[model samples]
Target: MDSKTGAAGGAKSGPRVRFAPSPTGYLHVGGARTALFNWFFARHEGGTMILRIEDTDAERNKPELVEGILEGLRWLGIEWDEGPYHQSERTELYRAAAQKCLDNGSAYLCYCAAERYAGGDHAEEEGAGGKVRRVVRCACRDGKPTSAEGQPGVRFKVPLGGTTRFQDAVFGAREFSNEEIEDFVLLRSPRGEETAGQPTYQLAAVVDDIAMRITHVIRGADHISNTPKQVLLYGALGAEPPVFAHLPLILGADRTRLSKRHGATSVTSYRDEGFLPEAFRNFLALLGWSAGGDQEFLRTSELIGKFSLEHVLRTNGVFDRAKLEWFNTQYLQKLPIEELLPEVEAELKRSKLWKEEWASGAGHEWFAKTVDLLRPRVRLLPDFSSWSRAFFSDEFSYNEAAREKFWKKEPRLPEFLGQLAGALEALAEWNHDACEHALRGVAEAAGVKAGVLINATRVAIVGEAVAPPLFESMLALGRERVTGRLRAALPAVQESCKA
Candidate 1:
């Protein structure tokens, strides 16, 4: 079977990986990278990719964030094969698994109330591997069943000796001694507001993974601490746990964890800022994994073909915003004009610069040519509306800095532009060659360098000191608008020159 369709082919098909996210906030970039990695692995191995929502904590989980998570995943083009199953919906499944652990002597009930330990002075104790840990051991471990029904929390019965070890697909063999793991809570019994029994994350995650037949657990390395406990839970259920792969953490340029201070953490934020989805995916792929060569820019299909857990680096990946912008620029140049026009048009409309006449015929052709001319100059989608605004609307203002530098340099600027505009207007053909000939002739008549006339004209027409090439820009702007802009800027040029 072909790799693309290999997941469903034979009896022994492929791995089943999952991208489980909590609905506490919008899907951040780190979470998006995790989702992408899982998707890459699933597609590479011809396996299923599932989307699970770990929303057990209803109090902290915002309902609106569920949409954001799904939307972000869709925006990244990471499609899931299985459900967006909610842990909230499967409470009974977790409860049944907890009961099985109790019956098989793998778990016990703790009657110790949290209030008793509140004021107690408990020193930090050394756990397995000689690491310091805050351990809260229950007093009910003397093999006594609680008489009070459903009033105590259920804790897992960790083995007394030996270590729990699992082979991580990315980081290799990882071992955690049982002593390091406290008898963590599984099911919390009825309390003040939470009258109904609820399954803790440790319990719910393990149970769901087992039920869903997840063949590989691919997530961030921050969850490495919880893997051993999960491994024990999988053993208690008399089931084999899936392969674990802990991804490296995504850090900022300061080498710290990625956060709001790092800028544009959310996938939706990048989309709003005019980052192409393809470029964003490529950027995420390079964060922790690479193709093992010097190829920096990769398409999505190439990524799927080259993706492997072995290439993923164990070192933390830095979230470089500047690198992301560079990737955006590359993608802007690669995509066809027709494909990018819709987004550019949308941005124009959003900025109130779009005209109804630009949808078809000559006006449409002009807009397409303008986009082609400005494509290389743009780094983001919003740049089209901001940097290329003069192409779309006549209401654009001169950048103050550009005005001070170009127009304010001399009063002769308006006369030079006037001569050039007159020459350009009188041309039979208003193309790039005609525009350049007219401007060069005017410069020769004024006894000034060609660059002086060209730079001044650029500032006059585009309201900026920098843009696409002068003649090309004017060619796209057309003769009528170009002459009108020169006449309009003549007053500002005279005023700034006097100042």
Candidate 2:
């Protein structure tokens, strides 16, 4: 669609959309969701996706946060095909656009005090059976002395009548009366003419969208009210408004807007917490969108091919923390072991479980097997270190609750496992079958259930009562380390037995 005509044209080129994020804070889920949608739309249509930093508000701008936003986008595998244009550097373009609106009589200079508002000392008339309504609420909106005084701010001259109608891609037709729309500011007044204050979002957005020829405006539904006002600015600036597709807001379990209380809203925080990039993207893509069918696990290419504004839910997307983990688990289980090995290795490094030998050579196969064995039960990459830490290093923490449960169940639990460890050490071949046979033989002779010995030995091996299959876990822990940890726990278990 062409920006000037707002018409669907031939196959000259595809949509030019942009994710213009304000670097006021870290890139959170809401911003990342918008970027993901924009990327999906662009890639699906074989068009360009531009990254624009809307950093005009210098007072709130954190230059450090800009890199964070970029990093989050790249981490999500959402790459742009064009420039990461900064609004800070485009102040001249905004100034010129505002000047053009003023010259064309579509905007006016307001010399009102710093406290000027949309409804305060402006025009008001009684409308429809004793209702006082505000219309064109700016003092200099009409033919007043258009002074560049009061460090005058420029305000758009909204039509006093008629309705501003636009077809929203998701919500369909939406109309707002011109009288109900406020005479919004284009640019804030400057302390002096030499330094013009930054353009308001109302003006800068329309100006930048026009300048960049953005054919689509895909953003959160929170900007719905701002659309009508921006639509007026687009008309006043003699540019057609882009096709607007407002996404539903992401909500918590209680249906309120997602925040810190909703848990870890930062995109990079999810990365730090070991959410796979593809899994994260899949989770975000499904937040407000549906690719049909009952299948929720869609690949990036699948998401791109299936994404459309038609399927975007008008209702808010609920961020289910458990559902996100489910997606991560699915990826963990199905992704290639080689692909998962590095992620597991990085996580081990973070937890100080990394060893150079485990990355390659003789130890590499064992590391890969350990990862593959544990991946089925993991929901995130960090679990490789946290849940199965003993597989990589012996300095793993034993859960006191689990330890006490097993040690106290049978005071002689250590005796049972010690004998089982010695039986395993005497094995002709050290493997899963031999270990299991040895452990069962010791349990049977001692008149104890094999499960008792299994649970107790698991705590001794992995420092936790729960893990992947016992024989598999023991195999990954290897024959020597398994026997060594079991024997090493004897003194601690002996102390617990007396207690």
Candidate 3:
């Protein structure tokens, strides 16, 4: 296979792309965007998408982080056709590739001491500056490279003269001169008392991509600099290079890279916060690429149908919180009640407000009613759990201001509450319309506006000024709980009157 002509001899039978992420931590928002672009490209072209976990660095790799990567992908609805392949599992493949390069004289083992190559000290300096500049002064360049048994690092011999150039689908043509690059380390001897140090990421990734038959490598623009190195490795292995597309970086609103400081960069964090998978995918897809037009929301199928790798932007795009919130609201409203139930339940469980009986027992109807009442008012399902707290538990803590303003000041507050409670208790049909009529009668008889009675009742029950509709909230809360809240609020109302 040639770099210009991919596998299948330049035949455009769609393109196979892979999202190769190192399992170091939770998948960051930047990595999520790369995954989305790769997913979009694969689906759009009717190609295969693979999820490869590049867990080559044993120190940094955690077995648990594999679940995080899969969870992130599942939450974003980015499915892969192949595997969640781990590089550690494929060590033999990388070792074979390295051996082939060594046997062909394209790679050699060097016995350079740590001090001579500036390892620890240089690594520290680069860390402080938030960049890595590895100085690989190859000791085996002219010394007639040995078979190299113990304590040696492998280095690829990069070709001198001319530039390594490739056409990127998003950033257009990119070229890097050979002088700008040095012979990089491919493998290092084991450091610990046990086990040998394995192949580096630069080597492992190139070998894995080629072995996996990845046709197009769709990833972030931050990795654009590493492309030439991998291209050089491809040549060293006597293998063809894959088509590369470096999608733009997603920045925070402050124009910095998206990180924890920007708030909730992980896919699990977003999902836990009640973002729909489709909406999250839509938000991620629009961060650097778009289907064109005023459309900001799209289903996975719609996105796949209209997606084009060439339409992806080269410039960095800011991750706007407002825009994501807007997208969330859209999905929140459009989602069916059945689809929204599990999310609502999860949020409740996370908040420790979840009751098994409420989800699985006679309380099921009440839970459904609660979701229905708050669905329109909420932008996220997690919001309903926090906001609708008073509905679930009898331990309602009223807002002090709401107690003073609505509960205390009104002279006929107790009388109105008593009548409303009595009417609610006598209701044969405890539905929205019936409850609204009964509550309104109490307000009319008290010679006050409906809002006055509604406000007082809401504060008495829900303990918050802003909530779902008053009557529906009361109906969902039930007669016993509603009366109990009203009775408990009486003393607070009297205290406010005295004050």
lDDT of 2 by residue, 76-145 (tens): 9899876677777778778888898899998888777454543344556787888966455776876563
Question: Model 1, range 160-222, lDDT digits (tens) per residue?
Answer: 779999889889999988777777888886587764468999999998888877889999999
**Candidate 3 per-residue lDDT over residues 1-499, each given as its tens digit:** 2231124333446678899998856888899888888888888888888788888887657778788888888888788877777788777777778888888887767666354343321232364677866653454654544334457667777766679888787888889998667777787765667354488889988987887688998988888988998998999888899888888888888999888898888888888778878888888888878787888778778888989987888889998877887888887777777777787888888888888887765688768767777877788766776667776666657887677678655777877787888888888888888888888888898888888888998998999887887877877777788888887777776666677
- lDDT of candidate model 2 versus the reference: 0.83
Cα TM-score per model: 0.91, 0.91, 0.84
Listed per model in order, the count of residue pairs whose N, CA or C atoms clash below 3 Å is: 0, 0, 1
Q: How big is the positional error of residue 113 in model 2, measured in Å on the Cα after superposition?
A: 3.3
TM-score of model number 3: 0.84
Model 3 local distance difference test score? 0.78
Higher-scoring candidate on lDDT, 1 or 2 = 1
| Ranking of candidates on lDDT, top first | 1, 2, 3
